[model samples]
Target: MKQFFLTLAGVFAGLVLFVIVTPIALIALAAAGSSAPATSPNTVLELDLREGLTDQPPTNPFAAFGGAELSVIEVVDALDRAGDDRNVKAVLIRLPEMGMTPAAADEVRQAVRRFRASGKPVIAHSQGFLPVGAVMSSYMVGASASELWMQNTSSFQATGFAADEVFLGDAFGRYGVTADFEQRYEYKNAVNTFTESDFTPAHREAMLSWMRSIYDSALANAAADRRQTPAAMRQAIESGPHSAEQAMALKLVDKIGQVEEAEAEAKRRAGRNAQLVSVADYVSNHGLQPGSGSDAIAIVNAEGAIVTGRDAGGGFGSGSTIYSDDTAAAIYEAIENRAVKAIVIRVSSPGGSPDASEQILAAVRAAKAAGKPVVVSMGTYAASGGYWISSEASAIVAQPSTLTGSIGVFGGKFVLTEALGRFGVDLRGLSVGGEYADAFSPTGRFEGQDRAAFAASIDRTYDQFIARVATGRRLPEARVREIARGRVWTGAQARELGLVDELGGLHEAIARAKALAEIPADRSVRLIRYPTQKSPFEALSEAFGVSAEGAQALVAVGGVLASPEAQGVIARARTEQLRARGASVLADQPVR
Candidate 1:
């Protein structure tokens, strides 16, 4: 019996070792075999926008396993390089069915325009366009190309923007649940989703403000590309969904055919024997690091909800979530690096924890004290806590459609006493010392002195937020207060209101950083990204403790659970979990 048990233990140990080593070996072999291919003469660069883009590169390599993943920076840099490459002739882009965010579309469209300026043709092909999301943004990008093509059967659904939200107040009331929340002012409507049945007056006004700004900007840009007046473009697009043939008649699209025909046209433009090379492949072959020099501009990415403590690292079936400690540490590291001349922090968040925002804001101040000028580049949305950390930057740059400036705070919790009673699940509470010790108890209501105390704390936080913005932007306290009232603004409106310094994207931010650091415009400076990405091998080693149980967990995580569909579900779940935890300074604006 003792021998049998020992043999079983040995077999289990071997199985664990095999399970661990096999994947590592296979991945290593795959990496070894996948050498970068050389670019041939007269190659046409093909870029597919169907794969969504993020602000920063994936934290782990395994993220590239299922499909090609590209960041906005990567796509822009690749096009910039390809424009100058003599071997590259033309570019082909495949548009998505749904659409992209307004900011992302603007950035890529600018790059496309720059590429077209080099006298090379850019052909954009769309399989179809849906009215589900920001379809107009996608059309704006396609219009930037030298020629736009749509599938024969595809419909052009570039209608105006509209926002729809589902409020849970009535449902919760029917179920005997209570949602108690407080805001510093009237404009902070995030809590309204839970406490009210529909959009409040302030909410409707704020939504319309940003949506109108985006609509106008998109029309103007697309009109410039198509050589038509903004009013004419708007009239044509707003005139209901157009069929492919109808779009051609209206001059909305230059050509109509299948995607394959579009590809053939691009290749024909590239001359005979021209190969269609993927943008990813081209980038991999010829590395396109922005610059290289002794002096460097550090890029710290703060994308996702800002919570306290170290980052969860977003490994295996997870998405990006910003952690305060990690972000602050990255800024500190940039400040400490002697070679670092300036810092450009890319921010893409709707805000998170108040404490975390304060911590990161302090780091930004410290970097300035160390003589490293900091420039903020706002992504899709940077409101509430996101704006908090960016308030003191040397300069702030944002896209015309970027949502920002929700300068307010809120705090409260739900009372589940009635809800639990309905389910016959009573939650009893016990107190130890202070009378208000159980005030935060989930089963009870927040009232009396305790509620007042909580409200006071929120008021103090809001005051601090306004003060920070006033000092950073060099505006009067009265002016800041007028804009504070928890209001949100688009980047264009924020610029006019003296909230944001410039209206542009990452490229503009980097240029401003160079000017502030006294670096010459003609000189090249290396870009060093902070909170550096980890290798898959390193991530795996840390994730799995090399034990049998860890190996088992790895297998379970990597199997059907790692599929693209499954990972998306897991990512949404993780986002909701993080959102709930970081609601203190949150100004969440759901993508339309």
Candidate 2:
């Protein structure tokens, strides 16, 4: 009786604590809202494009906890607004500090160019230690800047472009894991990393040509912007990276200075001494008013794989993975929101389950049925099911290097008959009613009938995939099949093949989406993210050990509780497996 009373007391204590903390948390959040900066005297918005460009807005839980990490779209929107704000003196292009992808960097570059065009002087500065791509992109935008500065102590690390692939064939062999995979063409090197020691001749040739084309184009653009010959830039990169002093001597940088010195130069050019504001602060201050209030555009970011359920910290954060259900629901909600004028579906997935892909595609169709334009912006890898969901978009945009159009489905079970035999395990089972009763057992390989059924299912899925593509792209069915033979293509190739309508990045896709939605180019649009907000307490409970009791209970009930930590480990492992399978649609290399 005393022990029962103690248990009851513990439950009561927990309930009381929850009630007390909930109101305090809400009050604290309310107080946080009041701390927004009223105004700034001198604001030079700094745009950092470090983590390759993303089509979807990032969710930063840390930001909710008081750190500031701007979403990609948020940064772009702020820069656009800052160009017209009278209090905003100048803008700074800080790409070197943030290693951004060519596409993402291009978005910022375009924004900076627009800001400069608005008669606001833009200053571009870099700390010399930057990747070749970042340096080249920054140079392109800094060309339009009133001044370009590099840190005195910094030096360039402009190693000419190279793409590296790690092969695990030998390791797999050592582990007795056979990677029996099939592909339709030599250019399909998706499975090569796991099956071969190095790139096949065809793979090497294609990748080399693609890289050369991208690097050459980038160099040409940078040369034109910085007023340096491509040949000179090529020579400098081939020889060695240059110090900031050497770069200035070579006319690569306008001046040698630190961030503060660059800020002073920006102030002098703007002819105003004003307080400097970050891109995040500037946007918050401007509020969510539209540019002209005529019409609005909605940006719906679909980053990561399309999964079937919700999993926090598993979308785009560090150690993140895909949650298909969460993604599908988010897309569905975005489609139903009345305030969302048009939908821009930004995809960066490899592919995953057919069910999850269909779920997301259904939402896409619903969005289109509502007379809202849906435009797809493809990121680095949007092949397989990534291509599946994108087929319904009114317009599709891809970058030159975007890897897309892997139109195939593969499914099989790994039979561990030999491994189990080695364990001295003799398994016997009673006959089930159906012939396919043992279909999922690991003890045996799939027989002729099972294989035939599986093949038929795959064929049906492939046909549906082809039909979807044909209808969505407005292409003939035969033509779709011609391009859908499990082959991958660069964005440029896909555009020529009609898989993509245009060759551009996310910003261009957004522009096209707005045009399709009949929104004037000058009108304001705010991106509304789906997935209802979770309170800080809920977030914290999820982060710690507070909310995982159900998972623990499930594992224990299943008699799989080898240890206290086993439940979490198993949950993570299963989550990763789902992510790997689903993310295959957008990923270039398999998930590591």
Candidate 3:
């Protein structure tokens, strides 16, 4: 027994040593081998959207290790800087195939337009715009460029966005699984997936309303960028998938050729011997220095599903989760920071725990009380609990295509009594408390007092939600209730309904924050990340500080860092990260 203990201790010590030493070695090598090239005259900054864009730098250090992914903010800042850079003669972008979230695409398109206004031509090249989903969003950004290039024989099938919801009510019934869910109102359709096979009238109405709004925004923006009338552009896009040649013929694309030819064209347009540099690399080495000014706008990112407690360290099956504790801490830090003039909380969630949402909202209120105006910047979508946290912000800004406002509550669980009984497994409960003690038991369904209690809890949550929205938006309680039946709304719709203050992206949100704080428009203000983003090494140290599992994860990370497959892992991890940020099963459809 003593020998076994000694061996186990020795193994743990060895693992700790390996985890610490291997990463340091890998970091040193990565630094030495990947030195960014010096920015020189006549350089063409290459922005590759082929991998898509993340809203922000990754929060997890382990995930951060595998890739050098640049966020939308990073790209926007880099392009803006490059526009004034004498060294950067032009810009080139490789469009994504899978497409980007409408909000992210809009932000990049705005940046591209700004870059073009500097008299430096921006060229966009696309292999194809496959019609998987949100492909038109990819085309929207491409259309904003000085030249749109497509690969030979590639299809341009960026038709429109469509989401398919999976209804498991029938399946559950057949399998003897009872989905016992209750919602505050009919339009809170998240529970409908388990309760009904088809869309209810309210669900259909809400879905079409937001979908059409987003589609119109995409079409109008694309048409304006392509220099065509909205009617003509709508007719062209609605007319099935067009070939690259057909797109060129219809003036939907500027040029058609292989990727190499497109590159040559970009080089030609850039004058002579213009070197192509990765925008990610350029930004890492020379992007706008954050926190460079005396006065700062602290950005607290509340991304993923709103939940209680601290981050779970992103273990297996752990998608993006915004812990209330972490989010509140970030907001409180900003409130206490003397240099912070205002706070901008970037939210991209579809809702989660109501209690968690309230916790975060309290922090936002605390910031306001401290004289630091709090502005909300909605990304992709921020519905239900997402909106709950945002309701009291000093100002709310969202992209036209962003989905927000699902002011409702729903809660319940799957009753597996019959299913388990059929399998000869009984999940019986032995309770010594009141009758409602078995209310949440998997083997029992809510009945009598338990049912009444559950219904009351749900109603309380709903009432609180509507009251908060009414108070925050300064609307009447009746007016809030009329619009609140848990229906999701597009940012454009929300703006019209007075749910959101403005329709814009993070850039505009920052501007709003500046105005509220009385900062001059012309003066540059330092942007500080709330919760204080740590260096990769610092995060790694914290990760390893936790447990043996963290050590094992670090070891796996070391293997990845040392291997050539690190790039591929980075791409996959980034996709997962984006999904966690944008995909929610609560209120809005998945963005991209």
Candidate 4:
């Protein structure tokens, strides 16, 4: 009674607060949408990346709670536009100490490269160059500028690249949990974390191969940019933990100075009195208006973990997810729309479900058959199922750091009867239907026949994945298989191996799509965002409905539980729930 009334009152208050907050946000976005870009004489486009970057900016309802983060596309397009603006005399990029993906860094570098082609100077200012713990990606982005200025007090730590994976088999065993799993091939070592104590031979080999390749690629590019030999570059990086003065002495950076000093240098180069323009503000003004042109290039964002059926959102902050039905429907919708001339599938996934990949690939083929040329634009990654869906595109464009490849399959369930028993919970399984009916039961392990069936399924899925790559890439099946053993490759290496046709970004993909469809280079095409953006109201409803129960539970347990660690425990339980329902996909890459 008292509790019921309290809960009811809480719900009502939440609803009212949500209703009140939503409209204010909508009105702000509306005002933002209507506002024109401010003009200034002798503009220097200021790109401060402290806001962070994403492959696709989350819709505002989710984003409003956080600080501003721009999409890679937005950043790149803005720079590209600034290249042609007469008023824009130079560019200033401020690299965040926190870091960004190598692929994103490469994209921004490409944009700067283009802007520099206009004979305008590009300068970079950073507090530090963080190359600690896979910060290689971040380092790659900062070094792209012609002149890099580091703060006098900052440090440079360029330790190069490595892949780290955690093994929980022994840890789980301590708790009496057993992972009953098998892989189709040796390369499919995703289950090793649960079934083995350390990396399998195949997993070790694959990780080493890709890590070395990335390291070498970075070394080569940095050498080329700095006019140093690869050998010298490697020596300099290995000799790191250098102070700003030491970094300058080592020729790693042009100078050690404050941000204001860097800005003064830009103004000096731009003939003085140059105004600074925020790239974000500029891009918003030049952003593509849907249905504005006679012909359209559909940009269908395929970010996050790809899953089957309709979009059932997951991931912390709803930051990542690619629903099979939603993606396929978006592709099909683009195909059906007479106005859309070409399609570009911008993929920034580490892979997901094999079935979901196939479904999305089917839609890509359907669009091609319907006469719309499809191009795949790879972001930070497009591996496993990410590569699966991309395999059938008319062409694939990827940044030099974009991680692709990894065609393999692995699946099974954890047998936790002993673990549960240790917790004073015992379970019994009864199945009268079929031999493999209890195969997925945590109370039991798979028998010989059930194990064989599961292996066969993985084998079949792997074969299908290989076949798609073979057909889409027009490579021999043998070659596809040769590369199919769950191998990851950077875009620079992938192109050499014939995995991607071009080493580029979203703009390159758009250009390729236009070329494939025979659209003239000078002709304008509407970049229509596909899968249709939802209204703020609809997005708010979705956000509230999806997480409302969890949010309420959080409130109810406020007294007993607190802090993010407590929240993390709850989140892990949610992940286990998702796993039990087979929600997470196989190609889901661990965050680098």
Worst 10 residues of 2 by lDDT: 583-592
Per-residue alpha-carbon lDDT of candidate 2 for residues 1-592, written as tens digits (9 for 90 to 100): 5544554465354333334333444444454355555556566666654433444444433332332255455666677777777777788776454234545445555566677778887778787645543345445556556677888898866545655788987776665445544444456577777779888887787677556655665677666667678898677655657888877777767888888888777766655566666665565555433444535555555666666766754121333234667766666676667777787777777777667788788888887898888888887568888899899889999876566888877655544555455577665555677767776566565677866666677778888888899999999999988767777676767888888998776668878988998877877666554554444444435544455454234323334333446545644554465454443223323212
Encode model 3's per-residue lDDT on 126-180: one tens digit a residue. 9988887677788899999999999988998977878778999899899899999
lDDT for 341 in candidate 1 is: 95
The TM-scores, one per candidate, come to 0.87, 0.75, 0.87, 0.85
Error of 4 at 211 (Å): 1.6
What stretches of model 2 exceed 4 Å from their correct place?
Answer: 1-32, 35-38, 48-55, 59-68, 97-99, 129-146, 182-188, 228-236, 270-273, 283-295, 310-341, 411-447, 487-490, 503-507, 519-592
What is residue 201's positional error in candidate 4, in angstroms? 2.8
Overlapping backbone residue pairs in candidate 4 total 0
Specify the poorest-scoring 10-residue window by lDDT in model 4.
583-592
Mind giving the per-residue lDDT tens digits that candidate 1 earns over 1-592? 5544554465455434344444653474365457755568888999998988876665665655534477777788889888888888999999988868888888899889989999999999997778867788899999999999999988988878877888999998988778887797899988888899989999999888888998899889999999999988998999969899988888889999988998999999999999999887776565446588878999998888889999544245336677899999999999999999999999999999989999999999999999999999998889999999999999999999888999999878888888889999998899999877887788877889988887888889999999999989999988998988888998999999998999888888999999999999888899888877664445555444454446445554555553557656654554465455552324333211
C-alpha lDDT of residue 563 in model 4: 48
Model 1 poorest ten-residue lDDT run = 583-592
- In model 1, the runs with Cα more than 4 Å from the true position are 1-36, 65-68, 284-290, 312-314, 546-592
